[model samples]
Target: MLLHILARGRIARSPEGELLDRYLKRVTWAVKHTELPDRGGNIPPLPAQARTVLLDERGKQFSSEEFAAMLGRWRDDGVREARFVIGAADGHGDVARGEADVLIAFGAMTWPHLMARAMLAEQLWRATAILSGHPYHRAG
Candidate 1:
């Protein structure tokens, strides 16, 4: 399955962007990153088997192992793209949240969008590594 991150805000040539690139490069699965302006950019078309996951403050928090399992399940079920949406500073609207297949949260604390992007990228790498029997993720 393709792991796609469709996020709001330009990451630019910043540390977060570098971190995102480094982790994403280590991921064995197909990965794509799409950045939109803080507002007004249309989300791209999704595949028929696409699964949308929105990152929100009220979203469910999953352990690294569990997150990997979720991706594994989607891959096994023939999902073509697992699209993770990270909204603007104001966060996602009700419409987006309602339409998402899953709403995920890193924690209760709010993070800058750029930092969140980097964190999400690292988590994606960890999840894929866990799925591929890699020792990078040492789960407790």
Candidate 2:
């Protein structure tokens, strides 16, 4: 399944952007990244079998094992894509959150939009590696 990350804010040529690129490039699955303005920009269209996941403070925090299992289940269920949305500084509105299949949180602490993008990219790589039985994850 395609793993697409749609994030708000310009990552630019910053260190965070470099980290995001490095991790994303290591993922064996199909991956795509879309960068939007900090405020306004339409997200790309998703495939019919796509599932949207919004990254929000109010979202559920999943353990690495659980996260990997979720990805595996979705793939087995024929999900064509899993699109993860990272909102701007103000975060996502209720309407936007409601449209998502899953609301995920890195932690209760708020993170900068750019760092969130990089973190998400790394997590995606980890999740995919875990799914493939790779030793990189070292799940506890």
Candidate 3:
């Protein structure tokens, strides 16, 4: 399955962007990264057989193993793409949240959008690695 990240705002040449790139590079699965303007911008239409995951403060927090399991299930079920949406500074609205297949949160604490993108990238790598029985993720 394709792992796509659709995040608001340009990461530019910041350290966060480098970090995000580093982790994404380690992912064996197909990956895509798209950036939208912080404000108004067109969001690409979702492809058929794709699942949308919205990163929101009120979303559920999953363990690394659980997340890997979910992704494996989706891949096994023939999901073509798993798109993860990260909203702007204010986050996503109710309508978008309602349309999402899943809502996930890093934690209750707020994180900068750039950092969130980097964090998400790392998690994606970790999840994929876990799924492949890689030793990178050490779970108790």
Candidate 4:
């Protein structure tokens, strides 16, 4: 399945952007990244067989193995695209959260949008690697 990140705000050329780029390069799966303005922007149409995952503070936290398994299950079930949405600075509204197929959290601590994007990139890489039978030394 395709792994897509639909996040708010431009990462620009900052350190976080560089980190995100580094991890994204390591991911072997089909991947796409979309950046929108902090305020208003029209989201692209979802692909057929799409699953939307919202990154929110109140969401469930999953282990790396669990995340990999979830993606694997979706792929095995013929999901075409797994879109992960990262909200703006103030975070997502209730409507968005309610509409999501899944809600995930990085941790309890608050992180800057740019950093969160980078972290998400790394996690995606790790999850895909684990799913492909690669050894993850620090896996939880």
Candidate 5:
């Protein structure tokens, strides 16, 4: 399945962007990153058979293993694309949240949007690694 990250705001050239890129590079699965303006901008059309995941403060927090299992199931079920969306500072609207297949959170604490992007990248890498039985993720 394709892992697509649709995040708001320009990441630009920064340490966070570099970190995000580094993790994404390690992911064996297909990956795509799209950036939207902090305010208004056109979001790319969702591909057919795509599942949308919205990152929200009130969302459920899943363990790395659980996340991997979910992704594996989606892939096995022939999901073409899994789009993870990171909204702007004000966060996502009710309509967007309602339309999402799932709403996930890093934790209760608030994270900077850039750092969240990097963290999400790392988690994606970790999830794929865990699914592939990679030694990179050692769970107790």
Candidate 6:
């Protein structure tokens, strides 16, 4: 399955962007990164087998193993793509959250959207690695 990140705001040339790129490079699965303006922009059309995961403050926090398992399950179930959405400054609205197939949180603490975007990329790489039985992910 493809791993796609549809986030708001341009990452630009920065440490966070570099970090995101570094992790993303390690993932074996197909992936994509889409950045939209902070305010308004058109979202890409979702494929029929797509799964939408919204990154929200109120979203559920899962362990690395659990996340990997979820991805594995989706792939096994023939999910073509898993699109992860990171919202703007004010975060995702009620409607968007309600429509998401899954809601995930990095932590309870608030983080800048750009930072969150990078972190999400790293986590996706980690999850995929874990699913492939890589030693990179050391469960606590």
| TM per prediction | 0.98, 0.96, 0.98, 0.96, 0.98, 0.98
Q: Residues 64-128, candidate 4: write the lDDT tens digits.
A: 88998999999999999999999998999999998999999988999998999999999999999
Can you give the lDDT of residue 103 in candidate 4? 96
lDDT of 2 by residue, 1-140 (tens): 99999988789899999999999999999999988888877778778998999999999999988888999999999999999998888889999988899999989998888898899888888989998888998855
**Backbone clashes, each candidate:** 0, 0, 0, 0, 0, 0
lDDT of 3 by residue, 1-140 (tens): 99999999999999999999999999999999999999999999888999999999999999999899999999999999999999999999999999999999999999999999999999999999999989999999
CA-lDDT, candidates in order: 0.93, 0.91, 0.96, 0.92, 0.96, 0.92
Deviation of model 1 at 70, angstroms: 0.3
Give candidate 4 misplaced runs (Cα > 4 Å): none
Residue 44 miss distance in model 6 (angstroms): 0.5
| Residue 90 Cα positional deviation in candidate 1, in Å, after optimal superposition | 0.8
Model 1 lDDT tens row, 76-112:
9999999999998899999989999999999999998
Q: Which stretches of candidate 2 lie over 4 Å from their true place?
A: none
Q: Which stretches of candidate 1 lie over 4 Å from their true place?
A: none
Better candidate by TM-score, 2 or 6: 6
